[model samples]
Target: MVTLPIEFRTPLTEGDVGALGVLERDGIRFEIDSGRLILIAPRTLWHADACHRVANLRPYAYGRQGMRISRTTVRCPDVMVLFAEPDPDASCHDPADVAIVVEVVSPDTAVEDRVVKPRIYAGAGIPEYWIVDRHPTDPRDASVEHFKLGVSGAYQRIGQAALSELEKTG
Candidate 1:
């Protein structure tokens, strides 16, 4: 098991989160409430494979691999779908430019992926968020929970389907 501990202790504003370097594990999930940096999770083979698959699906043009989708938001999701062409050299993106953010779940990141990330994405006005469900034991079958942000500023579960289904449809 590989562990990369982040040593950042400075109190940072929301926009400052973009300055943190992206790491192997999506890196850090900054605590906006308490202003603390927490290591996201260790990178696993399953997680890495799922990330590529989700990011490269149907709409390949808008996909971004390892970059922050929101300069004002804290957490960096696994993959992001930008409405506009992604700036190749840009480290952090504007929330208005991002349409969908995808997080591929693993054993270590399941809790954060389901709860914390959705909250951060919704608050940032991200139009959509997807949780690519992966189990620790059996990495073969991955399902997705598709969410769309509502007028009330919360993500509503719009659909659920297997990863294979999305690949097939796309």
Candidate 2:
């Protein structure tokens, strides 16, 4: 049987640094947070699709796999969309430029996505975030939980919506 390569991290930078130059290097997937590097592995289809939909946005889509942002480097849902005109000086690491962020949940990542990520995204003022639940017993239906940043610095659940709704909105 073929085995997948295990995901791992290599030290690159220090502190809450923002730019990570090692991602383009050979063999590792890196997410650059402020200054630290979190190594990740390539994502699955469900995760990539979630990011793609956000990128093929009406105005213009830019989907970046395993890009770093703020102090947390997220995999898969790392894609961001810009609905308006593009900024010449726009950087993927910039928190304000992101229209939406998506995260796919697995048993290992559920806690981080549910508890930690929201705080990070909210703190960055990321506007919108979608959490895709891929649990086995939760029905094969592709349901996504949406969240919008509230004034209180917490992600307010926009409730769960079918993938169809996302298609329509897009």
Candidate 3:
């Protein structure tokens, strides 16, 4: 819950237009926006573990590195699978090379995780996006929701399953 102070500013936008600041503390990540220095919330152990499990199960290279989807959109997804080998020196992965983006929801970022992030990913033309919710209304269990980008720069939910079901089968 403690974040080390760090000023991470990117000059991606036109002339003197300050963009983003990233901070990580205690395995949790945060982003500062509009000079407000708000916490972007860190991931829980359960969420982090889920990210690792997904990356390990994949047949390709993946990581929790920062992804710069657009000039105004920078995110560090829980897990990201790249289309090619990752550049070891790169600060952020190119959205075009990214295959999948997975976000595990926590209480602090529920709204952004479920709504805002999806819109940004879809706008960037990410092929697939996954939302793993630790709390769900039905059955009182975690659930995973899968979304595929539609032609109109929007996401279409394709499938969903409970975490318990996934564990039993996998």
Candidate 4:
């Protein structure tokens, strides 16, 4: 992990290219909460593969794309499936334009992936959210949890499927 700069501790506004540079330079993941930047763990190979698999499913789906959840928060989801083609000139897509968001969980990010992101994504009115539990120890043990936003603006656990099963059919 690259050393986090001291400046990142402060709150930032939208479209901060410098913060985006920090992400690129450090090779660390970031999630902005109320303009307060938070660190995400380095992704494992399994996590990356899961992202690729999800991205490959749809032509409009992309991996590691920045998204604006609110005016003050910018998050880069592991995989994003958009309803329509993204604007080429925009730095990040608005939450309303995203059809689904996928997070591939690592050991250090399990709680954030399973708990924090679901609430945030659901509140943003994203239709679907997927959490991929990529088992590092046992590839066969990996599974994905599917959540769908309910009318009350919360995510409800809908289904789960093993990664092995998906590979067989994918």
Which one wins on lDDT?
4
| Candidate numbers sorted by TM-score from highest down | 4, 1, 3, 2
Off by over 4 Å in 2: 1-22, 25-27, 65-77, 87-91, 135-141
Q: Write the per-residue lDDT of candidate 2 for residues 1-170, one digit (tens) a residue.
A: 22223233444333322234334344445554543445666777766665565455445456553324533454334555554666655444456666777776765677978888787778777888878775334444356788899889888987887665667886
- When 1 and 3 are scored with TM-score, the better candidate is 1
Q: Model 3 segments beyond 4 Å from truth?
A: 1-22, 25-28, 32-38, 61-63, 135-142, 163-170
What tens digits encode model 1's per-residue C-alpha lDDT throughout 1-170? 43434444555445544445444336434333345555554557867777778877835323334334333235456788878776677745667777888988777778888998788779878889999976434558678899999999999999998877788888
Q: Is candidate 1 or candidate 2 better by lDDT?
A: 1
List the pairs of residues colliding in candidate 3.
none
TM-score of 2: 0.68
TM-score for candidate 4: 0.83
Across 11-123, the per-residue lDDT of candidate 4 in tens digits comes to 66575644466676667667677877776777777778888877776678987677888777888999999999988766578888999999888777778888898888988
Q: Please name the candidate that would achieve the greatest TM-score relative to the true structure.
A: 4
User: Residue 15 of model 4: what lDDT?
Assistant: 55
RMSD of each candidate relative to the true structure: 4.7, 5.9, 4.8, 3.1
Better of 2 and 4 by TM-score: 4
Alpha-carbon RMSD, candidate 3: 4.8
Q: What is the TM-score of each candidate against the true structure?
A: 0.75, 0.68, 0.72, 0.83
Task: Give lDDT: candidate 4, residue 109.
Answer: 79
Q: Where does candidate 4 stray beyond 4 Å?
A: 1-9, 17-19, 135-141, 167-170
